[model samples]
Target: MAGTGGVSPSQTPTLPTQPGAMTPGRIGCAEIVRDLAWEHTPLGPRDRWDPAVTATVELVLTSPMPMAFCFGDRFVLIYNDAYADLIGTLHPAAMGRPAADSFGELWRSPGIGGVVEDVFRSGQPFLEPETQLTVVRAEGTRPEQAFFTRGHSLVRDSHGTIAGVLTVAAETTQVTRRLQNLSELTSRLAAALTVDDVARVVLGYAMASFDVDLCMFAVDDGNGFRAVRRIRGEMLDEADERLPPVWKRLSDDPHAPLVASARANRPSFVPDGEPLRAVASDRHERRIRALAVLPLRTASLKGSLSIGYRAAHTWLPAERALLNAAAQLVAQAAERARRFEAQHGTAQLLQRSMLPEHLPELERFRIAARYDVGVDGNAAGGDFYDAFRLADGRLAMVLGDVAGHDVRAAAVMGQVRAALRALALTEPDPPGVLAGLDRLVTSLGAESRNEEIFVTVVYGVLDPADGTITLASAGHPPPVLRRAGLGGEPPTAELVKVPPGAPLGLGGRWQTGLVRLEPGDSILMFSDGVVERRGRALNDGLDALVAVAAGASSGDPRNLCSLATTAVPGPTDDDVAVLAVERAVALSRSATMLVAAEPTGPSRVRQWMTTWLREWTVPEPVISSAILCTSELTTNALLHAGTPAQVHIDLNAVRLLVSVADTGTRGSVIRAHTDTMSSRGRGLGLIEELSDSWGTDPSVRGSTVWFELLLRSTSD
Candidate 1:
């Protein structure tokens, strides 16, 4: 008999279980395991061990990978001679002990032990990409901690019963954390849109990642390096002029470390002593023990990033590479910030041009909007929102998003916005208008078919006379409607409820719905940017938005819009546009318009007035009077004031009122009055002679020219 350690040597099945010693390339651990005496172990001597145990041991010892197996129910620890050094001082002693005795806290830890036990019982495997293990380094030493990507697998006996667990692992603490820090560098820099934003990201990361005592960013302001930003530790001075510039400033001072690094275009570090003393502040001369400076030089940006340590520290090669990579990536983002800071005007123009010049404030409807751009340049974001009066006197509103955030994408957004406006002007309803927009966007993308530009849009029209909203969507988020009867817990916000439609450029049909509002009820339309986040369901963000908006029943229209748009709890990466329309019973009988600064040179106001009349289906004589008044007022403002004009028209059962406003005040009622032959200012003179009531009033921007006509009873 094999004395309970195994079957008798004569009865034991012959498997190639002693290959660890026979294998020529086997190393130290294998030789040690093969030669060590196992008097304390149940398995006894190696050659006399059971065939199953011997085979499992051989499989572990002969492999180059770090592997260990617990044999039998007692789980005796057995591992290859390899990894003795990596296993720390517990190696040789660990070979014969039980797993708990050898691994200390790691094997005894509830979280880790459960994993191993589960694999043993289920005959399944457990994998951990990175897990922490704490083990005693030596008999008297405290525990040493490390991270490993590890796995536990069941080692089956010859009869297919679970015998023990095989643990295969690789230590990855330093490497994994380093890569994570590197990835964080780019991700943090990606969000910076201004120099201040860049400084926050850079200075913050330096202190956290480098364990530095002082960190500084000296921007090169065209002339030379200026210490515009810095985070000084307790021992450092506020403004130490002794610190070196990024360029050749005070060149005679040869000890300038930053200038030297900038000139060399490489990283410079001083491990300790006098080299640091030259750069040290007078108050804390001895506090500076170590320093490193990395130069930042991209085509559009120049600066120096530096870190100082109060204690002595050597720059490891890996640490040095990581710092260099961070500086390089951050410098590129800084360059973008600088360029955007310089070219902000163009961006402002693009943004202004992308949205409606003004949102009309009429009776029965109140309007407000928020357009927040996520990127720096080309402020015309991928998202857009607009409201304008349609030909038939109803209010048409649009919300949309292009597929990307780039200058080209914003330009394309402008084109698509214009196309949608033109289509909405003539189309009968939102669905038909969306269908037209789909074909238009599809044709626009044909030239860049490989790139495949796409857009999502929601269009709606509101009739102030009845407080009704007809909305349509094409691959866009549905509009949210909230009903709150003058405060308290608002009702659950309801979606317009439409089938999902494909994005524009895909040639698909769309869906539409009609929403009727109560006194305090409001409708909100937004781009997905307002309600989408990573790692969460799309409906989760939508629900959060509705919850916030439902409670925003009592506030300024602007404030209500702001509250809903900023409902998301964290920073966002995409452009957001939110347009809110609330039923305003107070202004139901009025309409307003924003005249252009330059009236397209040749009387645009006349055409606009004629269209408004026809759209309202006003009596032919009222239409005629509105047209004549529009031509007279617009021509007077264009010829005399050379500035834009604003117009407001109001109707009641008794009369019709038209008011025109401009930047200039009434100048002695001068007009085309004197020049009957010339088509110049007949403005105030014509108003006085052709209407029932007329007056002039001063305004904040300039003056308002007003006129009113009595409507004869149609019944007569």
Candidate 2:
């Protein structure tokens, strides 16, 4: 047989080993062994090699990732220090036992022990890319968790023949968790655009990634801390819709423990026992037991993300590292959400501010205007109306609706409204003004790229001398007409309907019409939401509006608008703008006044109003109402109408017109809350309750607001 001790080349059974192979002094092999065997000495310099090899065996046996060797049908496990920490108590007397005796649960796993046995028998190195296992130790209370195990076999020889196997593996729990969290984070980030959505994503990520029962994020709003996002069931039963129990304020609370500690770049982890005690009081103990708070700071602002568990659970350094990384990512996402919200909110506010602040006073008309945004949550729509006195002393009125609901539409609406205001001053006639607006829109490159933004507009120039309204339309609905003489009888009004011409930017000619206005005659102009609706005929909406306007009460514009709005008895999905212009009816022969020099005092003013009403034959039940109305109006004018403001009355035959003149320029807020227990603000609103027709007039010097009440006689 050709030298049995060392076979010939053709009959070789194993590869030849180089000199000094398996020796203790080899570079790569000896270095690995030394690391597996020794620990750095804390007191002084220590030798790298362990002479007896016992310390080396122990170090390998207690490693975090599993390491093992095989000797002919026997398996030996050599783990790092973490393995000892897990099973040291149970195996105190069995430190160096075989895998079959010490950890049967791990040794019996499929392909693990059998593969090591085969490697020892065949003298072959074996490797596995990935393996899964459930390690059930004898000491732990719960079942073992799932872990991915990867290992490779090391072939060893004794006396020129293969005799043993060596292996190593690492648990993959952290890796799996990271992948799941990343998937969830991507999904949430893609869908989240609002502040609330962002908060929910951060809190949800913590709950899922850290395996916590309660997770929440709080924002610092300068004044106090409030919970903006929270995981499901994270809060106590009583805190369903309420804010955090204790909202710590930085101004008054110098020792604001949570914020201060977070600012210091330190986290506080509590296993149990009043985890949030520094921020909340004893009342929060029932809900919060154990918590870890990590401060989230991005772009100079600081907030906190908190994770809580029902019971205290100890955490390892690796777990803390994972949480820190996640918090940083959350901070970045929150910053992005904030930027998106800022842009969106600014657009909305700008659109609202661009609307007419206050209606102008037409010489003989009582004008009331109302604007309502859509219920749908989309970008701003191009619905606008304006009533103002032109520089040449004529009344100019315009109402229009843009073509779409988006940023582009809102910006176009804004530009058009501004441009129309400027052009109306130079163009006297209605058609002339609209034509000028059309030319400007085409010339300013607003309609570039063949992209069109058509506008349906109705502009009018009212001659205050004769109450004649000269109107123009660019594919807009005809105006509605109502008169005081036709009240309660369904006013016989007609739509000054014109031919269907193209809207603005359609390269068509503009059309104009004229209608004479009488004292007590009203004209109503509105967007499509008022006269056109889905699933309903356009004529039906028009007829219904006509009937409601005929039945509306003359004294209050707010109530009249409300009545017309509710006429359809259905939902409106578009923005609505209703501008009503009516001539206030002059009073018949029934009014008188009693003037008092000392009208400044509240009691005296009350008495004077009461005596004057009594002399004018006012009803007994209505006297208290008149006094209350006058008192509120007088008081509000004194407090908010600016200095040097004065009150005056123009009493005629059939009506008493009370005028309050002041220099205040800001518009008044009007509310129609009907509850008796509510506190109604200001005197101007009270005038609406007592007067027949009321409105405000603003001038460069000041403003004059007037209200009227029907009188019984002029002889009192």
Candidate 3:
């Protein structure tokens, strides 16, 4: 309401005329006092209105607060500009209306009218420190419940009797809702597990709970900072390119809010929100006006969480304390989750290491080896297979099964395998290797005092120069021979009969059996578990195995192993190991090139490899990879071993197998993880990255580093 410089003498309220005749100073009060219906009130009319009633109405209308005056039996009402804002859609229509009609629902709710009535009857004031009331608001699309502290005073009329109640109130809705939301957030974050799970839960809840425009959590996983963000309850890509400013600021500023919080181990409140606005989206940069970062700390980890506000938000002491405490809990949960994952992974790695790393292959034969654990546990048992070329360039393969299936069995398996390898390098024949291994197992039993730690194995020696296999069995299953197709005869398989000699650790000397395999002939060596079923007889299981192999594609060892798995459709108690190799009757043209183990060895090897691949018309991609593998392996042998090296290249119908024999016994294929590795160590890593499959077999002379790549069958 606009006011004159001062009320003129002529315009002063001096007459006892009609209500409109006297101009009230306030707009809402003037409109109410001048209404024609006011003459019907207990006070009669504006001309007869009590001087005290007029004074209270003037106090309400002129005051800058959410105040309303109620007087007489009807409790007539009047409010100021501040109260009009609170009334929202119930404004002008509610003016000059009764208190009951002015605040219809609020009056009826919690019997607020009763408080006013009681204050009207008594001369004392009625006060409620803070209470909840649902009322319509401009900010809300519907009615919103809020907390308000209200006070009501009794006002008398012209006769000095009790008139009505005068109300003064303040809303505390935002503060009250915040406490409730924090409690809910604390409850939900309790069950979060992984970092991703924590981010999904916390970001979704924090944005809505704190009523912020954005929420982000950055975790330090010992490597680097990784952040997860949610904007108004919607997740954004953690690595979103548009958020470079935020990432850069966090990285560059040592004293930044989040950085400071982490360093000081406390929360940093940025009331101005300049830091947030500077990095926020263009639309929200102007909208968000405050930011805060809380340090997340646990026994093993420390991190930071940030929040941005779209409206002016002052961080309360209670709010800060709540977030800090909750973040500590979140940090503990995240730390435990990571620890559990690391421990579980370590256990799995230990179990997997007991199995073969990679199967060895040669041009005269392709090798396939597979070891499957028992149905009861993921831990590998004592079943093991190995195919390694001897120092003399002849291949020696072994399929062994140690009795029992526990940790002790696995330990003995390793010992027996080491003894067999050592014996193969010295003993010239398969029978000699078996006899030597038996004596070694007896000595191992004497040392361990575990007589039950016996082992059964089928040992064979293959001469690549000629097609011959010297085989011996020590109570192990006999080898299944898939005969070569010759002179229009279809291929057939027969179990190679050999004496089932006493198992190792029992002082038995096994005899050898020699087989001159024709071209296209193959041998399948496996542990007894492969053909031993729960209910079927051993002979029946063997027949089933042959049938499965017949139906399977004999293209590679992997295929044979996969077909072997189909033989036991149901669960089996024991672990299984299957090794398949195709015999070469008529050999292909092969080349052996020796490169001096010097600084130029790798370069010379690569040049020769390129020439050989071009002569064979190899694919360009394969040729490039071959050249790279050859250089890496050759360079590693020269730089690390300081011994002469040899490269044997064999290309046939189905595979391209390259063997780089080095005098270095320690050089093997590198694992994917390359931490704390030297130059040669990383070179081994490069071979792993470039080759399809590669391995190293330590011989008495040195080690043979080899890799194999599959080629289409028609390439044969």
In terms of TM-score, the best-performing candidate is 2
lDDT of 2 at 326: 58
Candidate 2 whole-model C-alpha lDDT, 0 to 1: 0.55
State which candidate, 1 or 3, has the greater lDDT.
Answer: 3
**Model 3, range 1-716, lDDT digits (tens) per residue?**
11111234333111111122112463453455456476655556677665445655665555444567776667766665556655555555666668787666555534356676776777666555465544444442454444466666666553445656667654543433443343334334444434555666667667666767877787665544556666664333332211111221145345455555665678777676467544443575446568888887766676788888876677776567556644654565567556644653343344446555665657667776666566444344788788888999898889999877677777778878878888898875877888888888888888888776778999999887676888889889988777755785666777887767888878887888888666667778888888888887889888887776665433334445656755755667887888888775435546788999678778888888888878988777777877777787777666556689999887765457787877653322334534444433455555666665565543334557777665543344
Q: Supply candidate 1's per-residue lDDT for 608.
A: 66
Least lDDT summed over 10 consecutive residues: which range in candidate 1?
A: 237-246
lDDT winner: 3
Give Cα distance to truth, residue 437, candidate 3, Å.
2.9
**Which runs of model 2 end up more than 4 angstroms from their true locations?**
1-218, 222-341, 375-378, 444-447, 486-499, 531-535, 555-573, 587-716
Stronger candidate by TM-score (1 vs 3): 1
RMSD of each: 21.2, 20.4, 23.6
- Name the regions of candidate 3 deviating beyond 4 angstroms: 1-363, 368-381, 390-393, 403-410, 479-498, 508-516, 527-548, 558-578, 584-651, 654-716
Model 3 steric clash total:
1
Question: 366 in model 1: Cα distance from truth in Å?
Answer: 4.3
Q: Rank the candidates by TM-score, best first.
A: 2, 1, 3
